[model samples]
Structures are given as C-alpha cells and as structure tokens.
Target: IYHVNNWYGVGVGSVVFYNDAIDANTDRSLYRKDHVYTTADKIRAGVALNNEFKFGLITAMVDWGVYLYNPARHYYDNPEHPIYGLGRRPLFYKNDGAGSDEAFHYIRFGMKTRIWDNLYFSASAKTHLHICEYVEFGLGYQIPFLKKENRKHGEKIFHHRKNWWQE
Candidate 1:
C-alpha cells in the first residue's frame, strides 16, 4: 500500500547571487562609507529530484546547484570596533570564507501537466522553509531525436500514474 515515485535529471540553469552590503561611519572617515557587492552570469549545474504522491497532482522536488566559480567581485563589511576602530573586512567575497561555497540549495513543491503531446508547462516555488525565493513558471517542449511514434517509452510513466509510491 506504499507508493513512491521519483524522477532525477542533470541540467544547467542560470543563477544569480545577491551580495549583502554594509555602511558605517568610521572614526578616521568623516563621511559614511558605503559598499555594494554582487555578481552576475553565474552558471549552476546540479541534479534535481521530484517525488509524487498517489491520487494527487502535487509533486515535490529538490534541487542542489554548485557554482562553478566564485563571484567576480569580492564583498567586504565595515564592522565598528571600540579598540581597533571601524575597518572593512572581507565578507562573502572570499571563495573560502564562511557560506561562500557558491552553492545554492532549495526545494520546490508544485505540479506540472502537458499542454500538448510534446509541449508541457509547470509551476513551482523555490523556498528555504521560511522565505520564498521566487515563483517559477516554466514552459518546455519535448523534442525527440526520432519521430514521435518511434520514440521509446520508459517502463515507469509518471504522467499516467496515479500513485508514485505504489509497488
């Protein structure tokens, strides 16, 4: 009476890293110092897994992406100090620094359906439990190397199945 369904794939996607900033007035500087750090055009590649339940259209997926390279620019933070005074210290800019591995871990819970035999659409949301990063609305078309009729079919068909965990 237990049904478990799963799907896995490896693919590449676009990734963006939003770096935090810090602003403070130091004793040596009369004006407030401000710094902004960020990076773009980051590529992410990882395996994604989706699980489905029986008698429902809901599906849960988890994606893990590891950034191939660190941010192009480094990040720094200005910490106020009573003894040493305020100074800018390396923050997320360093590749080896804390939480600087350039990896993103997120999970999605949603459903998908085929618009046509070859066209499909999906909707999901990436979240870290408390906060939702972005709502993903994707439309994709499946192109087969061979003719549609000649294309091979897997033993396990997801779209037609009622329960994924069924044995």
Candidate 2:
C-alpha cells in the first residue's frame, strides 16, 4: 500500500506492480445497498471484489492497487438499464471528509515507463472494483539533482564515476 496522489486525485492509496499477472484486484460487495453497478436490475450486486486473482499481460510494467480513501462516486440518470447510460465518470475532489470504509473503493491498473531521461509516459484505468470508470494518460517530468550528462550521438565515451551517491 504505497501512498500516492497522482492524476487520480486520491488522498491515500497503495499500489504495486508485480511485473506480471500475479497482481490484480479482488473486491467484494459493499452491502450498504448504495454502490455503483453496470446494470440497473440490481442483479449484479457489486463489483468490488477483494483478494481475487486476475490474469493480465504487459505492454509495459503493470500496476495494480486500491484507493483506500477515495471520494469518487458514480452518478446515474436512472436505475433500470443494463448499459450504464453515463459515459466515462467524472472525478472531483469533492471533500476531505469521505470515510475510508464507506467511501467508494476504487481500483487502478495501468502501464508506465520512462520514455526518456526523466520523462515518464503512463496510461491507467480507474475503477470502482472491476467496473472501469475511466482511463487516463499523462506525461511527467522529474527534477534530478544529479545531472547526468547526455551522451553524444556517436561518442564511445562512458563516464565512470566512483560513487555517484556522494555527488
């Protein structure tokens, strides 16, 4: 459970990329009768299935985790259709008061890799449990104190320093 607050706007969460399918989501029904569903018949009770193993592949390293403290909710126009009329759910930082257990427990899975020196390219899906809410892509720049000199295109020189840790 790593603490992170990325584009998801989460206050607290835990994430792990097992590098394979070994890591996945398993959430159970909230049972409160107030939850999100893909259908309206109430046939599909809930989507949050905890501790369940799911198989997946990687175009890049895979990440899976739970948003322990998520205030994000799914809004519906009605409750009598199989297709959730709503499109990709909208996310907002509503308030700082949603309970940890009562709030919607969202799941996030995605792929990310460093495209260049300190630039990262990432695309991930945000879901309640298994019900995917939306997918997001982002590029971030990381500030580095240790300036690693960019190598020349055709140079055979490789800088070998004794302990880069000590600057």
Model 1's alpha-carbon lDDT is: 0.41
Backbone-clash count (model 1): 6
lDDT to native, each model: 0.41, 0.36
Model 1 per-residue lDDT tens digits across residues 1-167: 11233444334455544422221332323223453322342222333444544333333444443333433222222244332234432222232333322223446566666655456677877653445646778897766445534433432334454433243
Q: State the weakest 10-residue window (summed lDDT) of model 1.
A: 19-28
TM-score of each: 0.45, 0.33
**How big is the positional error of residue 89 in model 2, measured in Å on the Cα after superposition?**
21
Clashes of each: 6, 10
Least well predicted 10-residue stretch by lDDT in candidate 2: 17-26
Q: Estimate, for each residue in 132-161, the C-alpha lDDT of model 2 and write its tens digit.
A: 556779896756543444422222111133
